[model samples]
Target chain A: MSAQSAKHMIAKNIGVLGAGQLGRMLALAGYPLGNTFTFLDTTGNPSAGIGEVIVDPENQHLAAFLDKVDVVTYEFEHLPVELVKQIEQHKPVYPGSRAIAVCQNRVEEKTLFDRLGIPTPAYRVVESAEQLAAAAAELGCPVVAKSVTEGYDGKGQAVLKAPEQAQEAWDSIGHTQLIVEAFVDFVREVSMIAVRGRDGEVVFYPMAENQHVGGILRYSVAPLPDLDPSVQQTADSYIRALLDELDYVGVLALELFQTRDGSLLANEMAPRVHNSGHWTMDGAATSQFENHLRAVQGLPLGATNAIAPTCMVNVIGLEGDNAALLAIADTHLHRYDKAERPGRKLAHVNVVASSHAELLEKVRACQALIPDAPPVEWSFESTL
Target chain B: MSAQSAKHMIAKNIGVLGAGQLGRMLALAGYPLGNTFTFLDTTGNPSAGIGEVIVDPENQHLAAFLDKVDVVTYEFEHLPVELVKQIEQHKPVYPGSRAIAVCQNRVEEKTLFDRLGIPTPAYRVVESAEQLAAAAAELGCPVVAKSVTEGYDGKGQAVLKAPEQAQEAWDSIGHTQLIVEAFVDFVREVSMIAVRGRDGEVVFYPMAENQHVGGILRYSVAPLPDLDPSVQQTADSYIRALLDELDYVGVLALELFQTRDGSLLANEMAPRVHNSGHWTMDGAATSQFENHLRAVQGLPLGATNAIAPTCMVNVIGLEGDNAALLAIADTHLHRYDKAERPGRKLAHVNVVASSHAELLEKVRACQALIPDAPPVEWSFESTL
Candidate 1:
């Protein structure tokens, strides 16, 4: 794992945007590769507890940051596209500015998906309540209306059972523009993570079945036992297309709906490492964080194959008893060092085992130790 | 994963003595467990390169270091015993001060091995050249004479091929006290690492066959294919006795030599993590670094079972082309962020595979890419 692109590798100062858990993990992975990190915190509330952070609430320290780092990569996608574009002038930015631009707006993301022939739920961009109702009528009932920009998790989203509720949904989601999508009746939600190096080499991890509670990911299990090889190939092809189209130089996660017809419909994609791929930390041959750093550093990507049947159980709000959780076999705890609060992601537990049954058992044992953890359930359980 | 012994886990500030690569890795492993680090560097030059370093050239910042940390641990065993003893009064130190005291003096270490009924090479502690010659004559030719107080990595030591060379060996060692031991005719060298928790429970890793060049560890392969199950049991029992005897609560490594008759002889032991156990980072279920932190933090020790056949190649003196090395499948690089110099350990690569045959193939491929790497050879290759 080289830190810089040279005949002989040398330590590089990696500039990171957004000081959150993802940045913290990136620094942890990058440090072993002989790289240092300097985080640019825009909100002045950096949670990536480790590393040197620059509080740049007004973006006045951009020149200082650009002068210190050899390359720049972001951990969070919500950063202003202009900020990333400006940094690109002084230092190389992985995933580029187009990635941030498209990911910031759902309409742009969907348009690219449509142009690239990646199937997505029927959708239309609307700016007013009347247009939202019209789009709902055209797409049919049970549509999800979301603000095109500045929406994550379940924020700024509303479900309209009928076109008559469009006005109420529009009022609830306080945004200038919205993307109304017809809800797909799917069997389960799944995501595939891929990394594309600077040399245009791409690698994909096995699809992970996701279980979300209140739109926040609760659990993710990789190498789904019931997943057909064709389905995996389809996912790989979909993400490969996205990676190449964006010329992505880091990890990209594509979330999809696995319908009963044995087809995948693209739901959304994240330009950076996604929560659904955290299971790779212990389950895959190389973690997503490490692969992301490798790609950003212009190094060859690592093996993406799953090492075993693994599950990631998110510890949200309240944390579990650390000693009790670690006492469980094959459980690895990763704490964010953030104080406990309702609806906050405090930590996650990675459970790995030789078989899916054993993995589920360990996951259940792990979940029992977490305080206020959602019930452990997976769509592949019945197949197993 | 708990940082303290309380019912609920909390982020702890860990105090580490000796800021070196071991301490850097300990902090890397500890950060995920939701702990912060503060290092006490007795030497002005600290190679840790990370963490909050308190350089106390005259022991002026001991109070500040102690004030910020909850529990204390040492990465190097050669620290001043009185400094550790003083730190013990303010904070709990894992492995205790007695472990350091015994490890610092070769005579004390050998005597403890004898008291614990651990077999060792024939040896005699000598104070003068005349006594050294008598001990060499008694023990036989080709005896190793090492300074009793300070000797490591073939330093402060000399080999006397004949009794008449005792004066030369004594003069070379430059110490008032020396321990002379007869060399053993062994099949090969091997080591076993074990971690003991605060509860007095012990877990041992599978024996790793080690290869050394100029007394510095060059390579180590774990879960030796030809090793008898009884041999592993013997090594485990030996380390377990040592751990309990010293009331040790951290990772301890014991080097041993396996004779042609399939018996193990105790060579020496390290109070902290050893170079031979670095393979555990990728090969075992739990790494030695994480286990050491867990033990020091009063948490339960993790599983020490090897996940696959693994080999660790030390990057000494020079570094390999990072891109070429990482191009190999299942190869993991961990650099210490140090400038390359003669006889310096810059980094290491961990190669893993499902079977020993495949692992050997990969290890050979990985070695070819490293600059100045020794030829790849393994004791288990013939068995494979």
Candidate 2:
């Protein structure tokens, strides 16, 4: 769909912030639309090929890449805010600074959630050691003390046994900005993905339950099993309210905690399309990559129905022969062409089936196809 | 899936016979599969870089190109059998030359059908003007007289309104080998796609009612409405019977006519994937393209169930701008990447919906998006 942009920047390309797999996939999806998209990266990542990735632009040349594109979007955060601000001056950045600023820090995201009246766990922003102790006193022991900024994949999150552990939590996170959050009694960790168009339309995909191992996301299944419809409503409401408050554009992902009382608590938000939404590429009517591109271009949002109850399992680098994984039945293997490094996300396989049990069986069958994949121990319990 | 062979051809590369959109799409599909799939074009043609299209291989030095690849396959028939035989001495040609020879001509295919006790229209082989006259007398008026070999897209076949039109029919076809057949009073036309793996396993996609205009396919809808289960069974039997008889490998599309009384008659066959089966790309659990690749590679056939009752419409080049076609809502537009010359097969769009009416609505919406596209008229009787 063509975007109705003003003549001023209609000829401009798009500047993508991060050059990771999402950027590569986005660039691939955008390539069909022609030379409308380009990416500028701070890292010399290999997947950044749809367009040029400016590793480090000089002060004068910095605006050249941003100037070439009409708008800016990002694939990942962790880039300095000052770089984003510099580009924002020359072009518009969707899921703009406010969203990314909040997303960069747990404390800021929670405060933004609280102010927006979104359902989130009770928490306090901690500064000094006294403030950490005070916040813990208000909450309780066994709480989560996490670095407010730049923490991902269970990093910087520490469990406090008492006031003694609180100092270590901030210290473990490099003693940057920190948050002392009350631990919610949760039954499951789930995520919701939605795209907000430039026209202010918010479209949500089916809620999916995310399972992680070693702090890295292992798999995600859509239409979370035995889910209450209310969870969808709450998730949609929370996303819409938050997006509207930020006037967000492009895709957003919300990490949610389903509490014992069946209440959904907001954990954090991602400004760009998240890994949990990757199944939508094969399983949904429109992939998150395509939908995000559409939304940012001011085009119509695509249908978000799950392709089926699909389970997506990520392959963290192959320790042995890659041939076994390639042999998976009817398998659509998406291996990122990045250099193989241990613990690096190599590829993901989406197993689509009619039912959950069948999906599990398919996953196991696929796992068998990949030699030396970590054994999947499947079980469920109600902490409530 | 790896193809086990006397020589692992994919170990080097592979050459495709035709450089049309089918070859182009196949090339795109194979990009992630690790092997560089190239093309051998009768004429140099640009087809989305499936690989380099080598024309005039004899003059260009076939050894140089052939040395670069191992196995060979064609995207479509119309390739000369001698060339295929020549290629076979070096690399295997899928769908085999014997199968192509039988399927490419009407006389051989019809004789094969008759031998298998496969039901088809009454017919007689025609050699000359005298033979045409006699065959017309035998088959009666309003019969079809046509050349046997290398005729497609309703070319060469002519309706004989009277005994005198037989000569004109023969003249129009420039007859080499020909057939005259009684025309069946069928209400609609349908095509079934079946794939045969190297192991001789066969899997069939559901019957699709095809709508054509000017001898070109306009649209095809799957899960043919009100079709008897036995009819599908008959169609499958027709496919399997042919598959076994020819020792066919890769995809075969059979065009069938259902007489007013509900009897099935084999009209013609395509040795490779046909336009009528394009709906399988997004409509089926696995695409016909991917399945053909699998079948030819000795991999297990993918499940062929219709994921959603789907409708596919061909996007023929129109008088005006084709750029707007990219905006079609809920439409998957595949531009051939061919420089559009008016009336050429420019592209096709496949739309999937939960119901027939929704599909029609989506089609209309798509038509609106392609303002420059030729006017699309829907058949009210389209089965979905």
Candidate 3:
């Protein structure tokens, strides 16, 4: 190649399927690498707040969006699989339609996990309250029933304390099909995020132990002090199997449960960058957003090494004092520019420190600055 | 205080005076902080590809630009001081008109240095060829003559090896007034970048040793391994004095010459975020761009600690292979989206590593990928 062509980046206009915080961050990371973005927002309310937006509620602008972008990727997997498949014929879509189809269905995702020999909470698919009650009876009471589709962020879900409550749970979910899963006595919730490049190259970030309050992720810290190397390896292998089986490209996040015996059960997987990896923005050698962009762009994957012990605190619903939150040392805030709304992911603050103890201290201090921020909680903090 | 107000970043439409790479980067860093930007391009040709640009070649849209923004900051200091002063009446301009006035004139800048007790190369100001020759004879045989105003990147500058070359140098420069100084026999050129908050809180980054070829910076590396803590302190004090004296409310970059005895002589100061500090984008806890925006917006400054050893390579005149450059591990490319031309800075590559040896190796590998990149050289490299 001539030197001129070699030195210049082949600037690509990436077509993003969903316009949310994930896509906003992808564009933010992509721009520095000489890429442009054209977002195709299926929802009428698009919150990317930056970049070019094509609000095609009826898919009227699909052809126009395809014409502008070199490659396509979705920020949220809730996108219609047929739309993704159609776009694939026109442009290359990372992770492809199969990953999305499986991820969108609870039964399909669990079946894939079983086929791949990945362990998960015992689950049974049911189309009626009678079957749900039978499944709850077989699995044990206090089971969780979730809609087979369109479920996310603890939405479309209900807990049945007994077989008698199964009818109420089914009525509450209001879905024709449901997956009733027996609750696992896991000690903590954790997630592993990995990225696979176009060339089938894969890199994994350190496992992050997560804290969820009211079914929303409140905090995540990576390079867990209490996590065994073997436990991390098992999580890596499980995700790697999924990535290879689906011929995936871009970042894939697998949410898992770490049990008292140091075993992990796969809870679910996201075909795009996950919120648990947001700490990588300031804590890792390369952020998950940048890695996702690089993977979809067919560039080499960057190192996923952690730079420090870091915590990511999600700012949900309400905003906090901008000055006070920032005053805490090593705090980096990323605001989504959305107005205050209940349960909305408005922003997140990533705090980095030399040690995990110092990190916890700062995180608690930061938590105090945000009004009504969930009380700072971490499974490892007690051990520390 | 209400939690809602505290959690929100009061979004501001920043009015930038120049639309160059620096302005482009400032906007890139500012966006995640939930800020917007409008560039007021005084020059007909502006290179900031992102953000809103008001091309006011005749200053006709000055009022419109001012009206759109809450506060103003300039990327390039060569702007007309009177224009900044006029804008100050309507809105705040950080680093103010006084900073621009002193930075635009060599005499005023050197006078400020003298008043603040900062050491500098012996110099004399002259208005005629005879006076220039007299200054050269008084300082020594070999002297450097620079234009009093409007010179940057080695432009409007001439080096005299002998006193007799003054007339030819004078005609070559074509400037009516010039400052001639005896060249200091320095070991190496270094720079200190510091940010002063609106309340006068100052923080300094570890000094970066810079390499220049034909007056354009080619490479810069920070947290020099061979540097003593005391030297860094001295450099910090020098810049702190300047920041306090000017009442600077943004990032200030000071270039200095380190003599054999480890003493530093002030070369010049730029009243804005500078090229040498670009390494902070990937290597520091808080990037210079973000700190500059924070200071101007009246927010607390983020930490300035270096994450690791880092090097920044400038892409000048020609482009290199993007894939090859990025293929280097831990390497990041920031392209300005500009067409390449002779002496034009098109992009930069930031290579970071845990140790100086590893950093040097990666930087060398990165340098080889660029078509016409200068040799990777650092004074501390030999020590490593």
Candidate 4:
């Protein structure tokens, strides 16, 4: 279709189910494109600073909020699928409830990956302590046990070092439906952000190598320096299969484990804009937040090519001087207005440079100003 | 001082006096930096679609709005000086009331240019029909007569083609305080945007060559192709002197007329972000809007380097398919969400390219989508 016709079809008002940093960034990205946002959160504080926030507890005010928007999408993937289904009855919700339902359950997510021939660790479902022990024995002595639902940020999961610990792990998790998998020996963790539009157009951002501390992402570097092409290709094929299977119409983030032999194994997926893609705000031709809005709004997707080498470091529980962060040359600081709390993401800094070395230097300079931030030295070398 | 100390001093909220496209753009830029905006206008529709707008009629409710923000600034330059002075009593206003007071009148503005050694077209103040005739005779025929206050976008001004038209021009303008000046026979119109920080740091963006139709700006091409270094240096010197003189703490724009002999003549000045600088949103490393916020908040200034050759075309009185404009590659569209009128500025399209030739191609492509837009072409070649 011509650009003119496509733009006339642009959604005037977009709705997000959750109001957080992702929703705030989405509103910020959509503002330039002439889209207003109405967010439905438990409280008004989620996106209160950026857009209109409607408090809708028990889905009582959902219909009224939906009436004000043309389309609906969610920020966090853990929203109740039934609530999204209720919204879908009134208006279209991008990445639909099926994708959200599958991602909410570890077993369902792994089963979909298996059906699509995506590479993943060996896994088996367990319902009770006896089943958990058997599954751990079958997978091997060391395995990761994850609950079927409501798991995130290293929560609702446990690692079993031996068969003897299987019962203990299951008991600790309250014996919910679980998936036990043989842990992969990975060299590093990386993620790729893919956007699939309503017209079936798909674009993938370069993989971002990530670092996590205590299950929370601490930093990420895009275009994963010295990454093997075959590894990226493998990850892309899996993302494509998932998008096709789910009929996805927004950004889908796939996290993978890069093994020592440069092979990729799917770890998980996020049905919305992911933290690893934050660097795109400064380093890419278009940001993931903007592209996500385009996909959900059914507009033409923007360029996803990286414009520079970039690194993003999350500011967790921040109480330092923001002026110090803004002082670094070429460093873009994003501070979410949420109150600071331990282990909560308060802000992030994206350092962009014409070259990887310069980006690293600036990233290190930014890291020095924030307390408790991890050191800024990368283990990989640039191959580009 | 260390960045930490500087960040600790960052302002929490900002207020804009007028909620138009300029204020909307400023809010978009400041959003990522964790700043919230409260706008005060005659009605809510001006900045209604974006930030919170407080209706303050007759400056009766100005103090209540001022109490909600940390610092205050404005979008339009023609705001009443007395009203701004009243707000200044409670909270700080960037670019201050003094700059606004001078720029609101043509005579005071030209006087400042003269005192700062900035070359301007030869002009004389006119208070009556007799003085108007004398000034036109002294400056020769074909002079421009402009009302000293409340004139913008070609309004409140008239050109006297012959001595006989002097009385007619004076009567047409309603005999307001005016300035009659020798008409500049220049090669082209250009403008420079300079941002001054609270710490006395000043940075100038590359000059933009502007095209105006009936006094409303139609398009702008940045880095002003084939611009002489000395001309740029002269413009910079003038901006620096003005910044120092006004103790300016935000973005200030100086529009100039380039002569056939490569000399520059000052035309006028704006105390806030100018329309010509809109291209910086997609073309520069840091947009003028963001820099203006940084200046007001007392944060370190961002980079002012151009990332590519860029051109911006205003979508005046638009009533067409926005999709066509968005379809152009590397084109950034900003719609102000205002009701379209016969000649109102509804939106703008920014086209960025690696080469000037490519930029013109995309700019032309965008122009073709908007109804009644002027043809796109650059008469000058790049000197860099």
Better of 2 and 3 by DockQ: 3
Tens-place lDDT digits, model 4, residues B1-384: 665445555687889988888999999899878888898887545744677888765557677787899999998888878878877888999989999998988989999999999999999998987789889888998999999999888898899887778788999998568999898889889999999999999999999999998788989998766877888988999999999999999999999999999889999999999999999998887899999999998988988878788899998885456766666767777888876688989888888877887887777787778878987645484433
What is the lDDT for A279 in model 4? Answer: 91
Ranked by DockQ, the better of candidates 2 and 4 is: 4
By TM-score, the candidates rank as 3, 1, 4, 2
lDDT of 1 at B318: 80
Candidate number of the best lDDT: 3
Tens-place lDDT per residue, model 4, A1-384, is 665445455798999888888999999899888899899997545644678888766568887898899999999889888888988999999989999999988888998998999889888898988899998888896899988899989998899988889778988988569988898988888999999999898988999999998899988998766877877788888999999999999999999998888888899999999999999988787899988988897777887777778899899886455777777777888878877689889889888787888888888888887768988646585433
True contacts kept of 3: 0.75
TM-score of 2: 0.85
TM-score of each: 0.97, 0.85, 0.98, 0.95
Candidate 2 chain A lDDT trough over 10 residues, lowest sum = A3-12
Clashes of each: 0, 2, 11, 7
| Model-by-model DockQ, in order | 0.60, 0.18, 0.72, 0.55
Query: lDDT for each of the candidates?
Result: 0.89, 0.73, 0.91, 0.86
Candidate 4's C-alpha runs over 4 A off are: A1-9, A43-48, A137-141, A228-231, A381-384, B1-9, B43-45, B381-384
User: lDDT at A350 for candidate 1?
Assistant: 92
In angstroms, the error of model 2 at A184 is 2.7
| lDDT, model 2, position A65 | 73
lDDT of 2: 0.73
**Candidate 3: where is the Cα deviation over 4 Å?**
A1-11, B1-11
Q: Please report, as a residue range, the 10-residue window in candidate 3 chain A with the lowest summed lDDT.
A: A2-11
